[model samples]
Target: MSIPATESDTATRALEVLRRLTARDDATFHEGQLEAISALVDEHRRALVVQRTGWGKSAVYFIATSLLRAQGAGPTLLVSPLIALMRDQVAAAERAGVRAVAINSANAHEWDDVRARLAADDVDVLLVSPERLTNPRFREEQLPELRQRTGLLVVDEAHCISDWGHDFRPDYRRLADLVDSMPEGVPVLATTATANARVVTDVAEQLGGDVLTLRGSLARTSLRLGCLTLPTSRERLGWLLDHLTDLPGSGIIYTLTVSAAEDTARLLAEAGHAVSAYTGRTDPDERVRLEEALKTNELKALVATSALGMGFDKPDLGFVVHLGAPSSPVAYYQQVGRAGRATESADVLLLPGHEDADIWHYFATASMPSPSKAAAVLGALGTEPLSTTALETRVDIRRTPLELLLKVLDVDGSVRRVQGGWVATGQPWEYDEERYERIAAAREAEQEAMLAYERGGTCRMELLQRQLDDPTAEPCGRCDVCAGPWYPTEARADSVAAATGALDRVGVPVEPRAQWPQGADRLGVDVRGKIPPGERPETGRVVARLTDLGWGGPLRELFAPGVPDGPVSDELLTASARSLRDWPWAERPVGVVVMPSVSRPQLVTSLAEGIARLGRLPLLGRLDLADGAPDQTSGGNSAYRLAGVWGRFAVGPELAASVAETTGPLLLVDDLVDSRWTLTVAARELRLAGADAVLPFALAAVG
Candidate 1:
């Protein structure tokens, strides 16, 4: 039984914690920081802080946690969005004399210890990702107790809670349910630097009706913004190479795609820049290393995708250059906000590419949950739990989208993931048709705004601030529009040539699938487990991926929807022959076999014929489609895709005879490889027909 902390006591303690956190006795609250902490600790209310970056949003939560714990309350529970942010917050919490610990994917081994400490009441703050809330074991075992015992709940990057936000996530929506279930007197706080009026209102309503919202101007005075319209990928790369060092201090070079990031990083490295690519595909351990390298100024800059967004803190970061524009102004502002946080001045440049709209469309469609697909998933499920692979065999949705749909369904209480897998909850779930349509329309408008930002005539900073509905948006007298372009308008001729040559280089490895997708037997496909090496296709080569920076542009044009099917172009044929010439194969191919392509038959045939002619190999007959076989549509999990094409192709008498005559390996060519199942089935057919080996070649591979 302890006494409640008074207002004066809370204020003194909060100030002490703030000073400790920042390691400066002279440091004071940044306008609303102290008020936010007092509202949580003293008033015990839900609050949302919408301030610009570097305004000490973390200080509010850290100091409030201190005061709450001092009042004999339970430890604060923080739901952070990213691992990098959690790491930084934990370190900051420790500096304030708060015992902080995080349980994320990177530290599963220490969870037991964390739980033990929680039981002993030794931890003052426990941070976890929003995904953790849906985990069956944690939801059942830890969350119930934690909710009742939590002193305060903090949702960092709270914009993710609203679908209208630029970076909405399904898991973040769980906060409403968590808040509803928490015991009375457990204060809640949500913080974000980038949120428009609509997102702010939506988040406030979700948190509760009686929530205190603190809004501020989104302008960054220390940043000088500018946009450059580059017509080609080569020119953008050349500009970066020519001016990367001259920009300012070490910073980030943001790319819209993983391949672009890797490509840019490679070219920069060749030019003696200490940079590395950071993307979703990067390993967890390596991500940590890269984050530290950037923080410590060990690397000049990181070539990154949006995966590097949110929770990365480098106060002295001198510049941020976007190789491609993001789809929305909110996202662009959030990313560029990373620069000039703790510096006097920093350069923020945008090199808008011609291909930006195409990439934008891909991401825009991918994130939206389809109603038909969700219904198909729900209809396929029963009372009993089923694994993702088993569900995939019954549904037509692709793996990534299916997984996202499941998360959405789970958040809506329509499904629940249990010990073994996921099960239907029998809860009614309605597709909010009007709301989804509105959100889609809003996204399109945002895209238009981004385009407007590129065609700049207004103050860049003012445009970004207004995009976030900042009431204080005004000209900063720093952007290119206000001061004229501060960056070079052109690249050196030699740099452009180097970039052009780099993009012109082709050849991407198309690795053969090893094990078959699980649960294929349920779909009437008998294959499972590892593919026999004797029947496997040798490692293959593709002219390029549809997502590559160089040749990808032409490949994307060739595969664009509504484009009429035709024979391969002469330039592509020459490039394909060059790929064959550069191949480091173990043994020369004796012949070339074309895979049946219903969509692009002429293109596939021409490509195979051209390769055979160039290599001086015999042109084997094309494999025939089995009777009653249908053309398989793209998009689905491995198992579903495999089942669709399992027995679709067969080696006809002519191709079989040709295979038998060829004692050495044969080359199998296709136009595009998406799931890689057609190539697998075709290679197996050729191998069964007594061909010594099969080598797969494709014009383009889907990313």
Candidate 2:
């Protein structure tokens, strides 16, 4: 049995823990922090702390951990959200004289050693990502013993646990189960700088039993928030070029998309700013280096997507500027909270884009799974293991939503993963239509609220606080609404031109699919492993990615659902011609052929004909699709995609004769290239027909 600490004993020990953590004699808790710490240390009660950034929430946990361990309790277990957060927490814990270890994707090689340390009681805190909780090996081999010894379980960025939260994560929902399983009277804490009243209530209920909820004024005194709506991407990039250096200390420039982040960073660098881009595509090792660079002020700014959003700690960050609006005010608050953490006066500016809603819609739909798709996935899975790509071939679901559904199913006990791939446990799974509907409705409301935030006349900071249900919400007198406009609306003409040029620049590499996807032979093509170099198309070129900052806008408009397919526009034709001329190749194509487009035939035909006419090459005749052939490029797994388009395309008699006659490489043009299976199968047909080589080209490609 554990004895409670006296108030005086808890106070003195808390001060000691703070001093060890900050190495400052004057360190002390702000407002309710001490009470939260005391509740854990003295009363052994669960608590949830909702406070603003820079309010020292991490201090509460570190101090509480130190005191708990001093009383002979076991190590703290932290379920953090990102690699960056884990790194910071481990370092913070060590600095405070608490030995710490983290087991995540980046440090897999150290897992055995770390597990030994934990079992031997050599570690004081262990930080793991939320995803690790669902791993079969970890769950069966390590978790049970780990849980028995865990002194206090901490869930950082607690809002993620709530389905209503702006950044809802399916894995975080597993915490509710963990909380219920913990030994009675062992304390737990959930901390987040974000979270509205609803999110707080939701997370608190998930925490189980009676939880002491301490909510604080969600105000960051250092932030001077404001919004500036831009009419175009060019103006937004130009503004950054003109005004980036004027901002105070090192900070982050947040963008709604990965391409925008990269484009902004590149333009800023060309104009002599020290900046780097951080996105989901960045390598894990590189992300660590970039975070350190920002913390050390080595880079003036890191242009980033929300990959850097939750649990990133950089006190004294000077500013945070958004290139476009996030879909929710709650998310916006969490991001802007990264700034003005330890200093007085940090500028927070939102440059909302006209195209933001379309991006929002695209991302939102990618997560919410349709019922039919979910059923197909379940029907396809059995005791046999199948990879994500395999499931795609069988189910109509795309990669993103399929993976999200898998996670949802795994947490719900409907499916379990094995070493080979994923296997269904033969458990019944319900669609949870009512819950999904509520979640969908909540998302739409958040989007509208975010839009209102940009259009609202009230104090920007106060508006945000009110959205989070902060009763103490009041005008901070620091934003544009409270004070006069502090930023310029106009950018220099030359800078605007530069920005436009950057956005206008087109052409991205289309690397050939080197190896045939696993299990493709069963699709009836008989091709396996590496394609013979002679049969494969050379590395190709696309006018641009549909997701590119330069071409994404026009391409999105062209491909948006229900848009009638038509001939390529004059400007796009000119751009396509330029792409052909700019493409660097070992040898120029001697002729051209068009791939049949089930969805955009006119666009494909007109563009191919126009190009062949200009280049003075024969339009060798089109690859004809057999009637009823499935549209391969739409979406599907590799094998089925191959199966759909495999025997679907054949060289027409004239095209076969022309290919046999051509002694040189031929170019294949299409409206778009997504999976590349359409091109691959078509090229294979041409190769068998005696074309010397095939060089594939598309107006746009999906990354």
lDDT accuracy of residue 123 in candidate 2: 89
Candidate 1, 1-703: lDDT as tens digits? 1222354777667777878888999776777777788789889999999999998898888899888888899999999999989998998889999999999999999999999999999999999999999888999999999988999999999999999988889999988998888898789999999999999999999998479998877889999999998779889889988999898889999999999999889999988999999999999899999999999999999999999989688999999999989999999999999999999999999999888899999988888788888889899888999988778888977778898999999999999999888999999788998988898899899999999999997899999999999999999999999999999999998999999998988888889999888888988889889999988999999999998999999999999999988889999999898888888899988899988888888899988898888888889889999865644788878877888888888999988887877788889999988888888888998898898989899999888
**Could you give candidate 2's per-residue lDDT for residues 297-389 as a string of tens digits?**
999999999999774778879999998899888899999999987798899999998788888887777777667777788899999988887
Would you give me the overall lDDT of model 2?
0.86
Determine which window of 10 residues in candidate 1 has minimal summed lDDT. Answer: 1-10
Index of the highest-lDDT prediction: 1
Clashes of each: 0, 2
Decoy 2 TM-score against native: 0.96
Over 4 Å off, model 2: 1-7, 383-393, 418-420, 522-525
Cα TM-score per model: 0.98, 0.96
